[model samples]
Target: MEFGTTSRTSGKPGPRRERSPGGSDYAVLSRQVQEAGLLRRRPVRGVVLLVVTAAMLAGSWWLFVAVGDSWWQLAVALPMAFAFTQCGFRGHEAGHRQTFHSKRLNNAAGLVFGNLFVGLGFGWWMNKHNRHHAHPNQVGRDPDIESGALVFDGDDAPGRTGAGAFVTRHQAGLFFPMLLLEGWNLHVASVRALRSRHTGAPAPAAVEALLLLVHAAAYFGALALVLSPLKALVFVLVQQGLFGLYLGASFAPNHKGMEMLSRDERLDFLRSQVLTSRNVRGGPATDFLLGGLNHQIEHHLFPSMPTSALPRAKPLVRAHCGDLGLPYTETGLIDSYRQALGHLHAAGAPLRAGG
Candidate 1:
């Protein structure tokens, strides 16, 4: 059997040329992966990561509180923000059922790590993220690409008017700065989702809301006890800003600047996942920083695969895509960001001209 051929299953040379909005090829890929036994959970690894991230968060918090001066506190808060980001990734994995075999355990962990500790609504995030994986970069379907401030596809371009025009014109330059508000935006969205009647289980939503309130109270109370009001405010801004920037920067390269399919455009699962996803070229440090998101193609294809297994899956996926004549994009982190920014600039050009 050739590297990318579907012959193993279908006795065919490769995937069919026809596109499938329902991701028909996904059934073939899933069968292959199941036979290869890549769907198993690594409970020990997940628990270890949880413990390490929790310790890091606790240590960073302690340092922040112990620092006598505001400047030193800010310095300590940087690590705290990074720790929070790691916890966020862990929560993401939990949401995907990648961390544990038991759905109940995974949900419990997601609630604690995502909702209580990180102040993100686990249920809300899962709902949004699952949609993203299902239809990445699809103009109308993928919420991640539907930002009002930043135009991705031509359909999202703003009409010439007001703040929309201003934002559309300067979105490329403002991308990084705008990300500084992403943390706050996520928290606000979480609260709104919890409050909305349409977000499913009222009991779970209320519990998540209560957890967020507790997180806010504990976070603000600790800051107030340890620092002056002004310093505390500054600390909050710096920490949340960094958290947002880090999170956004880490994720932006995955699909941004890649192909954008129309909502109605149909594509096989493999092509849809690979064409829109970009892999970061790096070593262990990159893996650690991106939380295995560097292998976005594989992650999208097999959302339930453990983070630790992503690297191992990469070569196989790349080879498969290669044989299928699919585009397999891999670039340095800095280069990927540059490409994303360039795409944004290009997308906004019409709005600027109209303005």
Candidate 2:
């Protein structure tokens, strides 16, 4: 048999054509984000979360008042713990454009959430977090995690060493105390934020400084007038500590060590996001507590989409990935945490702030 021209349809390249701007494929799965439930969009609906948070804050305030005795104030601020956590949640939703459709409302909530408590910085977090969504596993870019400092093999980020490493190695003892002083982990990025352009604007920075100052002055001023200093300290401790744990866990589990992109790690941004990010599957508890963050793939793809609608979109993502044969990792909440721990253990060095 003699070989002749093969059929083009049989795995042959088609005729080439001119490409359009950005050279991106026209097909896209993106949907314009909608508020969780429209028609209820307003200051009133915004309170849906604050309603829960308010009750908790009020109860904590009342309890702190009722018990001005020995160690009891420390024992009873549990409701306030929820309030602080919700404070983070409301701000997180604002960042995602899921809390309320109104940019002003969300920004206000985020600003308060940022500076409302002891250690939060809304401006810094919004920058890093939004970048994380854009870059996912891009090694040089994703600050959602500090992959530590030293790089091992191709993927491992071996951590800091020497005295700092020694401290990180023995970090457990310091966890509670550091958590206490820092106002949860809210202040974690504020210092770095100060030197950057984002923090350069005198207006926002002054606002940030004032918020921190007022945050301090108000609590201390309130303490001097009414409660004992020791009791006020305790209030800060419990709320900050619990909220810190929530903050760390909420973020770390999403993409601790899936696959990191290098400075040279070349990938299409959209593809990399799908490759590195995973879902927590879903459940009622995940929905309420996580504000539907468990829908990681859907969240990354359609970030502006209200978190509640992620469920509606999950299958669409899974289907697309299924077609592409790309890895789309998912696990339960506990399992994801376990995976983060595993990533840490494999790194086996001390954690650095930007690792």
Winning model by lDDT: 1
Please give, for residues 42-106, the per-residue lDDT of candidate 2 as tens digits: 45555666667656666776776677655765666566665666677777777766677677777
lDDT of 2 at 91: 74
Q: Residue 100, candidate 1: how far off, in angstroms?
A: 0.6
**Per-residue lDDT of candidate 1, residues 2-87 (tens digit):** 24543211122443345645765567667767777777889999999989988988898888867854667888778988988998
Checking candidate 1 for backbone clashes, the offending pairs are: none
What is the C-alpha local distance difference test score of each model? 0.81, 0.59
**Candidate 1 residue 276 C-alpha distance from true site, Å:** 1.2
Pick by TM-score: which candidate is best? 1
What would the TM-scores of all predictions be?
A: 0.91, 0.76
- Cα shift from native, residue 297, model 1 (Å): 0.1
Q: RMSD in angstroms, candidate 2?
A: 8.5
